[model samples]
Target: MLANSSIDNAASQAKTMFGEELIWLFIFGDLCTFTLFFFIFGHARTNNSVLYHASQAKLNVHFGSINTLLLLSSSWFVVRAASAARKGLIQKCTRALAGAFILGAGFAVFKIIEYIDKANAGISFSTNDFFLFYYLLTGLHFIHLLTGLSLIAYFIYNFRANGITRQNHATFESGAIFWHMVDLLWIVIFPLLYLLP
Candidate 1:
Protein backbone atom coordinates (compact mmCIF):
# COMPACT_ATOMS: atom_id res chain seq x y z
CA MET A 1 0.00 0.00 0.00
CA LEU A 2 2.84 2.39 0.75
CA ALA A 3 4.57 1.67 -2.54
CA ASN A 4 1.31 2.24 -4.38
CA SER A 5 0.95 5.68 -2.85
CA SER A 6 4.54 6.53 -3.77
CA ILE A 7 3.83 5.48 -7.35
CA ASP A 8 0.67 7.53 -7.39
CA ASN A 9 2.53 10.57 -6.13
CA ALA A 10 5.15 10.23 -8.85
CA ALA A 11 2.45 9.86 -11.50
CA SER A 12 0.61 12.94 -10.28
CA GLN A 13 3.83 14.90 -10.19
CA ALA A 14 4.39 14.13 -13.86
CA LYS A 15 0.98 15.41 -14.98
CA THR A 16 2.62 17.57 -17.60
CA MET A 17 4.73 14.79 -19.03
CA PHE A 18 2.87 14.71 -22.32
CA GLY A 19 3.45 17.20 -25.06
CA GLU A 20 1.02 17.87 -27.93
CA GLU A 21 -2.18 15.84 -28.04
CA LEU A 22 -1.84 15.29 -31.78
CA ILE A 23 1.42 13.47 -31.34
CA TRP A 24 -0.16 11.19 -28.80
CA LEU A 25 -3.00 10.40 -31.18
CA PHE A 26 -0.60 9.58 -33.96
CA ILE A 27 1.40 7.36 -31.67
CA PHE A 28 -1.73 5.58 -30.55
CA GLY A 29 -2.72 4.98 -34.16
CA ASP A 30 0.69 3.58 -35.04
CA LEU A 31 0.70 1.36 -32.02
CA CYS A 32 -2.65 -0.02 -33.07
CA THR A 33 -1.28 -0.83 -36.49
CA PHE A 34 1.75 -2.52 -34.98
CA THR A 35 -0.49 -4.57 -32.76
CA LEU A 36 -2.21 -6.00 -35.79
CA PHE A 37 1.12 -6.74 -37.40
CA PHE A 38 2.28 -8.58 -34.32
CA PHE A 39 -0.94 -10.50 -34.11
CA ILE A 40 -0.54 -11.68 -37.68
CA PHE A 41 3.02 -12.75 -37.02
CA GLY A 42 1.92 -14.66 -33.96
CA HIS A 43 -0.84 -16.39 -35.83
CA ALA A 44 1.49 -17.39 -38.64
CA ARG A 45 4.05 -18.70 -36.21
CA THR A 46 1.46 -20.68 -34.37
CA ASN A 47 0.44 -22.35 -37.58
CA ASN A 48 4.02 -23.34 -38.36
CA SER A 49 5.94 -23.50 -35.16
CA VAL A 50 8.68 -25.75 -36.55
CA LEU A 51 9.52 -23.44 -39.44
CA TYR A 52 9.25 -20.40 -37.25
CA HIS A 53 11.60 -21.89 -34.68
CA ALA A 54 14.13 -22.83 -37.33
CA SER A 55 14.03 -19.43 -38.98
CA GLN A 56 14.20 -17.77 -35.60
CA ALA A 57 17.35 -19.72 -34.89
CA LYS A 58 18.98 -18.03 -37.87
CA LEU A 59 18.74 -14.65 -36.14
CA ASN A 60 21.69 -13.39 -34.12
CA VAL A 61 20.58 -12.71 -30.57
CA HIS A 62 23.79 -10.81 -29.92
CA PHE A 63 23.06 -8.26 -32.60
CA GLY A 64 19.51 -7.82 -31.38
CA SER A 65 20.70 -7.46 -27.78
CA ILE A 66 23.32 -4.89 -28.74
CA ASN A 67 20.84 -2.92 -30.80
CA THR A 68 18.36 -2.98 -27.91
CA LEU A 69 20.99 -1.47 -25.60
CA LEU A 70 21.81 1.18 -28.20
CA LEU A 71 18.19 2.25 -28.48
CA LEU A 72 17.65 2.28 -24.71
CA SER A 73 20.78 4.41 -24.26
CA SER A 74 19.62 6.71 -27.00
CA SER A 75 16.26 7.13 -25.32
CA TRP A 76 18.01 8.01 -22.08
CA PHE A 77 19.92 10.74 -23.85
CA VAL A 78 16.68 12.05 -25.28
CA VAL A 79 15.19 12.18 -21.81
CA ARG A 80 18.22 14.14 -20.63
CA ALA A 81 17.90 16.46 -23.58
CA ALA A 82 14.28 17.13 -22.74
CA SER A 83 15.17 17.70 -19.11
CA ALA A 84 17.99 20.08 -19.99
CA ALA A 85 15.77 21.93 -22.39
CA ARG A 86 13.13 22.37 -19.72
CA LYS A 87 15.83 23.79 -17.47
CA GLY A 88 16.94 26.20 -20.23
CA LEU A 89 20.38 24.62 -20.33
CA ILE A 90 21.22 24.95 -24.02
CA GLN A 91 24.69 23.44 -23.99
CA LYS A 92 23.60 20.38 -22.06
CA CYS A 93 20.58 19.94 -24.30
CA THR A 94 22.69 20.11 -27.43
CA ARG A 95 25.17 17.57 -26.12
CA ALA A 96 22.36 15.25 -25.09
CA LEU A 97 20.74 15.55 -28.49
CA ALA A 98 24.02 14.72 -30.18
CA GLY A 99 24.50 11.72 -27.97
CA ALA A 100 20.98 10.56 -28.73
CA PHE A 101 21.53 10.92 -32.45
CA ILE A 102 24.78 8.97 -32.43
CA LEU A 103 23.38 6.11 -30.42
CA GLY A 104 20.23 5.92 -32.54
CA ALA A 105 22.33 6.00 -35.68
CA GLY A 106 24.43 3.15 -34.31
CA PHE A 107 21.32 0.99 -34.17
CA ALA A 108 20.78 1.59 -37.87
CA VAL A 109 24.37 0.73 -38.70
CA PHE A 110 24.18 -2.54 -36.79
CA LYS A 111 20.88 -3.39 -38.42
CA ILE A 112 22.36 -2.86 -41.86
CA ILE A 113 25.31 -5.03 -40.94
CA GLU A 114 22.97 -7.71 -39.72
CA TYR A 115 21.08 -7.58 -42.98
CA ILE A 116 24.29 -7.80 -44.96
CA ASP A 117 25.36 -10.84 -43.01
CA LYS A 118 22.05 -12.49 -43.77
CA ALA A 119 22.45 -11.64 -47.43
CA ASN A 120 25.89 -13.20 -47.50
CA ALA A 121 24.35 -16.35 -46.14
CA GLY A 122 21.72 -16.23 -48.94
CA ILE A 123 18.76 -15.39 -46.71
CA SER A 124 16.15 -13.11 -48.14
CA PHE A 125 12.57 -12.15 -47.40
CA SER A 126 11.48 -14.58 -50.09
CA THR A 127 13.30 -17.37 -48.28
CA ASN A 128 10.33 -18.24 -46.10
CA ASP A 129 7.34 -16.93 -44.15
CA PHE A 130 9.35 -16.15 -41.06
CA PHE A 131 11.98 -14.29 -43.03
CA LEU A 132 9.27 -12.30 -44.74
CA PHE A 133 7.76 -11.15 -41.46
CA TYR A 134 11.20 -10.43 -40.04
CA TYR A 135 12.10 -8.16 -42.91
CA LEU A 136 8.74 -6.42 -42.99
CA LEU A 137 8.63 -5.76 -39.24
CA THR A 138 12.21 -4.62 -38.92
CA GLY A 139 12.02 -2.61 -42.09
CA LEU A 140 9.04 -0.65 -40.85
CA HIS A 141 10.83 -0.16 -37.54
CA PHE A 142 13.95 1.06 -39.37
CA ILE A 143 11.85 3.68 -41.08
CA HIS A 144 10.49 4.87 -37.74
CA LEU A 145 14.00 5.03 -36.28
CA LEU A 146 15.15 7.12 -39.22
CA THR A 147 12.24 9.45 -38.65
CA GLY A 148 13.16 9.78 -34.97
CA LEU A 149 16.77 10.56 -35.86
CA SER A 150 15.58 13.21 -38.26
CA LEU A 151 13.52 14.75 -35.49
CA ILE A 152 16.56 14.75 -33.23
CA ALA A 153 18.51 16.54 -35.95
CA TYR A 154 15.68 19.04 -36.29
CA PHE A 155 15.69 19.68 -32.56
CA ILE A 156 19.43 20.24 -32.68
CA TYR A 157 19.00 22.67 -35.55
CA ASN A 158 16.42 24.64 -33.61
CA PHE A 159 18.65 24.79 -30.56
CA ARG A 160 21.54 26.05 -32.67
CA ALA A 161 19.36 28.73 -34.20
CA ASN A 162 17.13 29.72 -31.30
CA GLY A 163 19.03 28.57 -28.19
CA ILE A 164 16.19 26.84 -26.34
CA THR A 165 13.20 29.04 -25.97
CA ARG A 166 9.79 28.40 -24.43
CA GLN A 167 8.33 28.68 -27.93
CA ASN A 168 10.12 25.55 -29.11
CA HIS A 169 10.03 23.63 -25.87
CA ALA A 170 6.78 21.86 -26.71
CA THR A 171 8.07 20.93 -30.14
CA PHE A 172 11.15 19.36 -28.67
CA GLU A 173 9.01 17.46 -26.24
CA SER A 174 6.88 16.18 -29.10
CA GLY A 175 9.99 14.88 -30.81
CA ALA A 176 11.09 13.20 -27.63
CA ILE A 177 7.72 11.52 -27.36
CA PHE A 178 8.00 10.17 -30.87
CA TRP A 179 11.53 8.95 -30.28
CA HIS A 180 10.32 7.17 -27.18
CA MET A 181 7.52 5.51 -29.09
CA VAL A 182 10.07 4.22 -31.56
CA ASP A 183 12.14 2.85 -28.70
CA LEU A 184 9.11 1.29 -27.05
CA LEU A 185 8.09 -0.45 -30.25
CA TRP A 186 11.56 -1.91 -30.61
CA ILE A 187 11.55 -3.05 -27.02
CA VAL A 188 8.55 -5.16 -27.95
CA ILE A 189 9.95 -6.24 -31.27
CA PHE A 190 13.37 -7.29 -30.00
CA PRO A 191 11.99 -9.81 -27.56
CA LEU A 192 9.25 -10.96 -29.90
CA LEU A 193 11.75 -11.63 -32.65
CA TYR A 194 15.02 -12.45 -30.94
CA LEU A 195 14.28 -14.03 -27.59
CA LEU A 196 10.92 -15.72 -27.96
CA PRO A 197 10.94 -19.50 -27.89
Candidate 2:
Protein backbone atom coordinates (compact mmCIF):
# COMPACT_ATOMS: atom_id res chain seq x y z
CA MET A 1 0.00 0.00 0.00
CA LEU A 2 2.79 2.41 0.89
CA ALA A 3 4.68 1.74 -2.37
CA ASN A 4 1.55 2.19 -4.44
CA SER A 5 0.74 5.47 -2.70
CA SER A 6 4.27 6.75 -3.31
CA ILE A 7 4.10 5.88 -7.01
CA ASP A 8 0.75 7.58 -7.37
CA ASN A 9 2.05 10.73 -5.69
CA ALA A 10 5.04 10.83 -8.02
CA ALA A 11 2.80 10.52 -11.06
CA SER A 12 0.58 13.34 -9.80
CA GLN A 13 3.58 15.58 -9.28
CA ALA A 14 4.87 14.84 -12.78
CA LYS A 15 1.52 15.75 -14.29
CA THR A 16 1.34 18.98 -12.34
CA MET A 17 4.81 20.04 -13.44
CA PHE A 18 4.26 19.07 -17.09
CA GLY A 19 0.86 20.71 -17.50
CA GLU A 20 -2.13 19.21 -19.35
CA GLU A 21 -1.72 15.86 -21.06
CA LEU A 22 -2.67 17.28 -24.44
CA ILE A 23 -0.02 19.99 -24.32
CA TRP A 24 2.62 17.43 -23.41
CA LEU A 25 1.49 15.26 -26.27
CA PHE A 26 1.76 18.17 -28.70
CA ILE A 27 5.21 19.12 -27.46
CA PHE A 28 6.47 15.55 -27.68
CA GLY A 29 5.14 15.23 -31.23
CA ASP A 30 6.89 18.43 -32.26
CA LEU A 31 10.12 17.28 -30.64
CA CYS A 32 10.05 14.02 -32.54
CA THR A 33 9.46 15.77 -35.86
CA PHE A 34 12.29 18.24 -35.38
CA THR A 35 14.65 15.55 -34.15
CA LEU A 36 14.09 13.57 -37.31
CA PHE A 37 14.72 16.60 -39.47
CA PHE A 38 17.93 17.41 -37.64
CA PHE A 39 19.15 13.86 -38.06
CA ILE A 40 18.45 13.95 -41.78
CA PHE A 41 20.23 17.27 -42.12
CA GLY A 42 23.27 15.89 -40.32
CA HIS A 43 23.38 12.79 -42.42
CA ALA A 44 23.08 14.76 -45.63
CA ARG A 45 25.82 17.15 -44.57
CA THR A 46 28.10 14.24 -43.80
CA ASN A 47 27.51 12.70 -47.22
CA ASN A 48 28.02 15.97 -49.08
CA SER A 49 30.50 17.90 -46.98
CA VAL A 50 31.86 20.25 -49.67
CA LEU A 51 28.45 21.12 -51.06
CA TYR A 52 27.03 21.75 -47.59
CA HIS A 53 29.92 23.98 -46.56
CA ALA A 54 29.89 25.92 -49.82
CA SER A 55 26.16 26.49 -49.51
CA GLN A 56 26.42 27.43 -45.85
CA ALA A 57 28.97 30.10 -46.80
CA LYS A 58 26.33 31.92 -48.82
CA LEU A 59 24.10 32.46 -45.75
CA ASN A 60 24.03 35.83 -43.96
CA VAL A 61 25.46 35.29 -40.53
CA HIS A 62 24.71 38.84 -39.39
CA PHE A 63 21.00 38.50 -40.01
CA GLY A 64 20.98 35.15 -38.27
CA SER A 65 22.76 36.59 -35.24
CA ILE A 66 20.38 39.53 -34.95
CA ASN A 67 17.38 37.20 -35.09
CA THR A 68 18.95 35.02 -32.44
CA LEU A 69 19.29 38.00 -30.11
CA LEU A 70 15.71 39.04 -30.78
CA LEU A 71 14.32 35.65 -29.86
CA LEU A 72 16.48 35.44 -26.74
CA SER A 73 15.25 38.83 -25.58
CA SER A 74 11.68 37.85 -26.27
CA SER A 75 12.15 34.73 -24.20
CA TRP A 76 13.47 36.83 -21.33
CA PHE A 77 10.38 38.99 -21.44
CA VAL A 78 8.22 35.89 -21.38
CA VAL A 79 9.99 34.71 -18.24
CA ARG A 80 9.33 38.07 -16.62
CA ALA A 81 5.70 37.94 -17.65
CA ALA A 82 5.25 34.54 -16.12
CA SER A 83 6.88 35.69 -12.90
CA ALA A 84 4.67 38.80 -12.78
CA ALA A 85 1.59 36.67 -13.31
CA ARG A 86 2.56 34.49 -10.39
CA LYS A 87 2.78 37.58 -8.19
CA GLY A 88 -0.57 38.93 -9.36
CA LEU A 89 1.01 41.94 -11.04
CA ILE A 90 -1.27 42.11 -14.01
CA GLN A 91 0.05 45.40 -15.38
CA LYS A 92 3.65 44.24 -15.24
CA CYS A 93 2.73 40.95 -16.78
CA THR A 94 0.90 42.66 -19.63
CA ARG A 95 3.83 44.94 -20.35
CA ALA A 96 6.29 42.04 -20.32
CA LEU A 97 4.11 40.02 -22.66
CA ALA A 98 3.79 42.96 -25.01
CA GLY A 99 7.54 43.37 -25.08
CA ALA A 100 7.92 39.71 -25.91
CA PHE A 101 5.40 39.99 -28.71
CA ILE A 102 7.14 43.01 -30.20
CA LEU A 103 10.52 41.30 -30.12
CA GLY A 104 9.02 38.28 -31.79
CA ALA A 105 7.59 40.53 -34.45
CA GLY A 106 11.00 42.05 -34.96
CA PHE A 107 12.38 38.57 -35.54
CA ALA A 108 9.74 37.94 -38.17
CA VAL A 109 10.51 41.19 -39.93
CA PHE A 110 14.22 40.43 -40.01
CA LYS A 111 13.55 36.95 -41.31
CA ILE A 112 11.37 38.28 -44.10
CA ILE A 113 14.08 40.67 -45.16
CA GLU A 114 16.60 37.85 -45.17
CA TYR A 115 14.32 35.75 -47.29
CA ILE A 116 13.88 38.60 -49.73
CA ASP A 117 17.63 39.06 -50.05
CA LYS A 118 18.12 35.38 -50.68
CA ALA A 119 15.45 35.42 -53.34
CA ASN A 120 17.08 38.39 -55.01
CA ALA A 121 20.32 36.42 -55.09
CA GLY A 122 18.52 33.68 -57.01
CA ILE A 123 18.54 31.20 -54.16
CA SER A 124 15.66 28.78 -53.95
CA PHE A 125 14.95 25.58 -52.11
CA SER A 126 15.63 23.62 -55.27
CA THR A 127 19.03 25.22 -55.70
CA ASN A 128 20.73 22.62 -53.51
CA ASP A 129 20.17 20.21 -50.63
CA PHE A 130 21.51 22.73 -48.11
CA PHE A 131 19.19 25.43 -49.37
CA LEU A 132 16.33 22.97 -49.20
CA PHE A 133 16.95 22.29 -45.53
CA TYR A 134 17.55 25.95 -44.85
CA TYR A 135 14.26 27.03 -46.31
CA LEU A 136 12.24 24.18 -44.83
CA LEU A 137 13.65 24.38 -41.30
CA THR A 138 13.67 28.15 -40.97
CA GLY A 139 10.25 28.43 -42.54
CA LEU A 140 8.84 25.90 -40.12
CA HIS A 141 10.37 27.84 -37.21
CA PHE A 142 8.86 31.05 -38.55
CA ILE A 143 5.44 29.44 -38.49
CA HIS A 144 6.01 28.44 -34.89
CA LEU A 145 6.93 32.04 -34.02
CA LEU A 146 3.74 33.33 -35.56
CA THR A 147 1.71 30.81 -33.60
CA GLY A 148 3.46 31.82 -30.39
CA LEU A 149 2.79 35.48 -31.10
CA SER A 150 -0.90 34.75 -31.44
CA LEU A 151 -0.90 32.93 -28.13
CA ILE A 152 0.89 35.85 -26.48
CA ALA A 153 -1.69 38.24 -27.88
CA TYR A 154 -4.45 36.18 -26.35
CA PHE A 155 -2.66 36.12 -23.00
CA ILE A 156 -2.18 39.88 -23.13
CA TYR A 157 -5.88 40.38 -23.77
CA ASN A 158 -6.73 38.07 -20.93
CA PHE A 159 -4.34 39.85 -18.57
CA ARG A 160 -5.72 43.28 -19.46
CA ALA A 161 -9.37 42.27 -19.18
CA ASN A 162 -9.62 39.43 -16.66
CA GLY A 163 -6.26 39.74 -14.93
CA ILE A 164 -4.03 36.79 -14.13
CA THR A 165 -4.23 35.57 -10.59
CA ARG A 166 -3.15 32.47 -8.72
CA GLN A 167 -6.31 30.71 -9.87
CA ASN A 168 -5.50 31.33 -13.55
CA HIS A 169 -1.74 31.26 -13.35
CA ALA A 170 -1.62 27.81 -14.86
CA THR A 171 -2.86 29.19 -18.16
CA PHE A 172 -0.13 31.82 -18.24
CA GLU A 173 2.52 29.26 -17.35
CA SER A 174 1.41 26.93 -20.10
CA GLY A 175 1.65 29.72 -22.69
CA ALA A 176 5.09 30.62 -21.42
CA ILE A 177 6.17 27.01 -21.77
CA PHE A 178 5.10 27.03 -25.40
CA TRP A 179 6.88 30.30 -26.07
CA HIS A 180 10.04 28.95 -24.45
CA MET A 181 9.89 25.93 -26.69
CA VAL A 182 9.79 28.21 -29.70
CA ASP A 183 12.84 30.06 -28.44
CA LEU A 184 14.66 26.80 -27.70
CA LEU A 185 13.99 25.53 -31.21
CA TRP A 186 15.50 28.68 -32.74
CA ILE A 187 18.54 28.41 -30.55
CA VAL A 188 19.16 24.94 -31.93
CA ILE A 189 18.47 26.05 -35.49
CA PHE A 190 20.66 29.16 -35.49
CA PRO A 191 23.86 27.30 -34.66
CA LEU A 192 23.19 24.41 -37.00
CA LEU A 193 22.07 26.52 -39.95
CA TYR A 194 24.36 29.52 -39.59
CA LEU A 195 27.46 28.88 -37.51
CA LEU A 196 28.16 25.16 -37.93
CA PRO A 197 30.25 25.36 -41.07
Give the winner by TM-score. 1
Model 1 spans with C-alpha error above 4 angstroms = 1-17
lDDT (0-100) at residue 30 of candidate 2? 92
lDDT of 1: 0.88
Task: List TM-scores for all candidates, in order.
Answer: 0.90, 0.89
Q: Give the 10-residue window scoring lowest on summed lDDT in candidate 2.
A: 1-10
Residue 95 alpha-carbon offset, candidate 2, angstroms = 0.4
Clashes of each: 0, 0
lDDT, model 1, position 3: 38
What does candidate 2's lDDT look like per residue over 45-69, in tens digits? Answer: 9999999999999999999999999
The 10-residue segment with the lowest total lDDT in model 1:
1-10
Query: What residue pairs clash in candidate 2, if any at all?
Result: none
In the predicted model 1, the residue pairs found to clash are none
